[model samples]
Target: MQLIIFKDYNALSQQAANEIISLVKHKPDAVLCLPSGSTPLLTCQLLVQKAKAENVDFSSCTFIGLDEWVGIPPDNEGSCAFFFRNEVFKHLHFSASHIHLFNALSENLAQECAAMDSVIFENGGIDLMLVGVGMNGHIGFNEPGISFDLYSHIAPLDETTTAVGQKYFKEATELSQGITLGLKHLLESKKVLLLANGNKKAAIIQKALEGEITNALPASIIRQHSNSIVMIDEEAAVMLT
Candidate 1:
């Protein structure tokens, strides 16, 4: 894993964006696996700016959402659907047609999951997947105890995950399950970019980078990824030496 520490969250994100832009320049139609939550917001902004200022084309690009909270209607303001439409796609002005998201509400959710995995495989797999390390080191809500080799599945959110996600939800009880592309899918990407920022993440970031490769800290599994890049802000990198 490659680590890059920056002065602040925004700087860390910009550096990550530049790395992605470098890849995009080489392959404009790259399939980018995007994540949600606070850490990636600035990175997305920088990415869209790169597309605009440099006239980088996103028309041929495709986006796959990392995960979605179960049971929320697509129209709900608090949904992951809402975050993608507002924070990433709308700002970047990418065609809604090329964006793919897993809807937990589909009548045949089973079929949808199977189709998504098939489509990704047919498309030469994902080029890069942007990820945010949860405070507990959970990656894509895989939580603790789950094997990283498991593919796509519906994950029952742990109490900590549900509570942390409540920052976006109205009620903690309303947040239970999440439809996440499994750790296997994340590792399948040609490259992985994991971002962490702020004082809140300092402990986990340090542990993830400096600690052992064990299931107790799921993000540490990225240590095994040949192309994984762990980007962090100053505060988050504090204990990493």
Candidate 2:
């Protein structure tokens, strides 16, 4: 595990983008795990701008969504798929066929999980997984108390997550469950890039990176991975020594 505290969000996003751009440059077909939410929005934008400026090729890179709210339509504004489509995919020069995302509306949820798991398995596993730590230390929807041994599975959303996530919806939305690539999948990645911004994330960021490894704080488990990097703005890094 490695830690990098930047002066502000832009700097953090730039650094993160550079790292990802480097990966795609070296391996255009690299499989990437991406996240939604405001924290990573700027980073994805920067990645697009940089890739365009450098004429970096992303036509062969594969993108995999990390999680999605269950029961939501893929086209719904609140769905992770919609968020990524508008935020990341629309900005990339990648092939549409290479974009893999969890099916939150799958009638047979178990089959959905199995299918996504198989996709990851067939892709030779994720080469780079970009993540964002939630205010409660949750990673993807693997909330506190989630088993680290699990693979792609359904997760019940934490209260804190539901409340914090409400802002994404156009109106009132109740998200009770989520479909996510389990912590095991994230930990198994060849490289992990986790980002956090804002002073509101300061305390949890400190705990996740500097505190003990435990499932109770899902992001803390990143400490167990051999190739994980954490990037945070100074505000988010305020609690760190």
Candidate 3:
């Protein structure tokens, strides 16, 4: 894994946006797995702006959502699908056919997992995966103790995840499970970009970078990936040794 620390959040977001734009420019059809939530909001916004200003065509790229809360509708404000639609997809005019996201409302969630795995496989695996680390060091919803060998699966959300996830909604929403692409997919991706910011993330960022590679800290598994980059702002990198 490689680490890149920026002076501040804006610089980190700009660099992240630039990396994504450069990938799309070089490989218009690049398959991407992206995360939702506050950490990536600025990056997604910058991406939309730069793509529009520079005439970056994203209609050809295929997008895969990293995870979604179980039982949430795609249109719900707190859903990962909604986050992408409002922040990136609608603005970029991404083709519906090129987008693959979890249907958290599906009766057969196992089938949903299978479908996601199929899409990733058919697309020759993910070209790039952008993820954010949770306070407990989870990636996607792959909480502590989740097996790194698994692919797309339903995960039991960690208590920390359940608590932190509430910030996405306007009111209290019970969040217990998540359908997510597993760490296996992240490991197999051609490139993985892990983004973090704010002093709140400093200690976990340090652990994810310097701690031992173990399922107890899912983000630590990124160390095993041949081409993974950990990009964070100075505040988030403060605790790094």
Candidate 4:
């Protein structure tokens, strides 16, 4: 695991965005596994601005969402699909066919999972993965428990995750099932960037750093990732080193 401690969250996010921009500039065809959350929102916006100002080309880039909320429509603002579209896609010039999002509301969830898995395989896996750590140390909704080494499959979510995710939903019941890329799929990425920001994430970040490796904290599994880069602010990195 490669850890990068920054002076503050903004600087950390900017640095991350800079690196992503460099990658895209050099390899516009790279597939990027994106995350949907406040932590990556600013970074995405900055990247779009940078692209616009410098005339960077992203026409060949492919954007793949890491996860989506089950039963939530793509138009639902609370869904990851909506988040990615409004926050990143609409702002960039990426090819529409290159952008991929899993239909969590599909009646045939099994088929959707298989199709996503095949798509990832056919694309030769993700080249760059952008991720955010949850307050419960969760990544891509792979809530800790009974799943230490998993692929793109269904897994139950922890109550804490749903509760925290409710901020996007207008109703509490709207926060329930989540479809996430398994730990195995995440580890397949050639390069991984995990961001953690705010005091709200301090405890979980510390737990991921100090606590023993266990299924209870899925984010901790990144420690075993071959080329994972973890960036955090002073508050989030307080207990990391």
Candidate 5:
């Protein structure tokens, strides 16, 4: 794992966006797994701007959502699908066939998990996975105590995750479970970029980076990935040793 501390959020977002742009430019058919949240909002915006300014082509790239809140419709403002649709997909004009996202409302969720895994496998695994670390040190809804051995699966949301996730919605929404690509996918990805920002994330970022490697802190498992980068702003890196 490599660690990079940026001067501020904007710098961190730029670096993240640049890395993605470079990846697509080098490998037009790169398969990506991306997270949705406040931390990645600026990064996604930057990607759109840079894609246009630099003439980067993303039409051939494949996108896979990292996770989604169960029982929510994709069109719901709070859903991960909605976040990507407005932020990256529409802005970049990504081909519909190149996008694969979890159907949170699917009645057969296990089948949804299988389909996700199948897609990842068929695409030759994820070329790059960009994720945001949750306040609780969770990555892609692989909350505390989640086994790193698992692939795509339905996860029971931790209380901390359920509570913090409310900020995504305008009105109160029930957030109990999440269908997500698991830690195993993170490990298997050819490259991984983990982003975090704000003072609120400092302590958890410290724990995930400087503390023991354990499933209790799911982000810590990134330490074992052959190629992973943990990038954070000064505020989020404050607690790091």
Candidate 6:
């Protein structure tokens, strides 16, 4: 695991984008596990700009969503699919057929979870996974106490997670659970890029990187992975030293 602290968000985003572009260039068909939410917004924009300027081809790349809020329709503005369509797919050269998204509303959630895990396993696992640490140290919707052995599954959202996520929707939305590609899958990736920013994330970031490994702080499990890069802005790294 490597921790990289940047002076600001722009620097962090650019570096992260460059790393992703490099991986894609090296392996055009690389399977990527992508994250949702505000943390990766700038990184996605930087990727769009870089791809356009460099004429990078992402048509052969495969993108898999990290997680999705249970019961949220794809058309919902706060949905993970909606975020990918607006923030990622719309900005890249990727083919629609190459994108694999989670079905949050499936009547058979267990089967859906198994299907997601099978896809990743059959595709030779993820080559790269872009992730963001939650303020409470959760990764993907895998909240505190979630077992590290689990793969893709439905996870109950922590109260803290739901409260923080409510800001993304215009109206009051009840988000009780999420379908997430688990830590086992994320750690199986050939490389993982974990991102965090803002002063609000400082203390948690410090604990996740420097503290003991524990399921209570889900992101700390990244330490067990052979190849993991943690990128944070100055404010988020304030507690590091």
Candidate that would win on lDDT:
3
Candidate 6: tens digits of C-alpha lDDT, residues 138-187:
99999999999999999999999999999889899999999999999877
Q: On a 0 to 100 scale, what is the lDDT of residue 86 in model 6?
A: 93
Candidate 2 clashing pairs, residues 3+ apart or interchain: none
State which candidate, 2 or 5, has the greater lDDT.
5
Worst 10 residues of 4 by lDDT: 146-155
| Higher-TM-score candidate of 2 and 5 | 5
**Location of the lowest summed lDDT over 10 successive residues in candidate 2:** 85-94
Candidate 4 local Cα displacement, residue 203, angstroms? 1.7
RMSD of each: 1.6, 0.9, 0.7, 1.4, 0.7, 0.8
**Rank list by lDDT:** 3, 5, 6, 2, 4, 1
- Per-prediction TM-score: 0.94, 0.97, 0.99, 0.95, 0.99, 0.98
As for candidate 5, its clashing pairs are none
Ten residues in a row with the worst lDDT in model 5? 132-141
Which candidate model has the greater lDDT, 2 or 3?
3
Clashing pairs in 3: none
Model 6 poorest 10 in a row by lDDT: 90-99
Question: Worst ten-residue run, lDDT, model 3?
Answer: 204-213
The residue-level lDDT of candidate 3 at 83 comes to: 95
Kindly list the per-residue Cα lDDT of model 3 for residues 107-200, writing each as its tens digit: 9999999999999999999999999999999999999999999999999999999999999898999999999999999999999999999999
- Of candidates 6 and 3, the better by lDDT: 3
Count of residue pairs whose backbone atoms collide, per candidate:
0, 0, 0, 0, 0, 0
**Which prediction has more favorable TM-score, 3 or 6?**
3
**CA lDDT, every prediction?**
0.82, 0.91, 0.95, 0.83, 0.94, 0.92
